[model samples]
Target: MSKVENSSAESGQVKVPESVVMTVKNFRSASDIDNFYRYINDNRLRREAKMILDTVVKAITPPKRRRRSKRVVH
Candidate 1:
């Protein structure tokens, strides 16, 4: 079972559709996850998937930062 399995509708929470669950569990890349994210019809399920995707993206992508200029001290 993948991490996606943890977000199943069978858990007795908000019932996410099976198609959505299947899509997520079978995800092989970020684009697959994004497809499911767009496919979910339920608001609650969509939010849950969004949260997971956001976390996944954050974990995989490097953070961007602006470099500061160095100053000489007198």
Candidate 2:
């Protein structure tokens, strides 16, 4: 099994790795650092809101059933 599958099986929740890479030309001032902090905070809030919305959607929606294939006999 893959690492993701094993983790999901053990914890009942999947762990996905997320990242953001950016190159800053002049990242030397206090305001620049503050702006970066605010950006991170905003992203965190958005992610949390998305997770809550997804949970609510899942609770409201029904699970889909898989169709079974029938074998043909000659």
Pick the TM-score winner.
Answer: 1
Give the clashing residue pairs of candidate 1, or none. none
Q: How well is each residue in 4-64 modelled by candidate 2, as lDDT tens digits?
A: 7997989987565543323465453457677866776877776776687799999999989
How much lDDT does candidate 1 score? 0.70
Q: Give the 10-residue window scoring lowest on summed lDDT in candidate 1.
A: 21-30
Candidate 1 per-residue C-alpha lDDT over 6-66 given as tens digits, one digit per residue, 9 for 90 to 100: 6764575665677566554457556765666557754458677778889999999998997
- TM-score, cand. 1 vs. native: 0.38
lDDT score at residue 30, model 2, on the 0-100 scale: 52
Candidate 1 residues lying further than 4 Å off, grouped into runs, are 1-39, 42-44, 65-69
lDDT of 1 at 13: 69
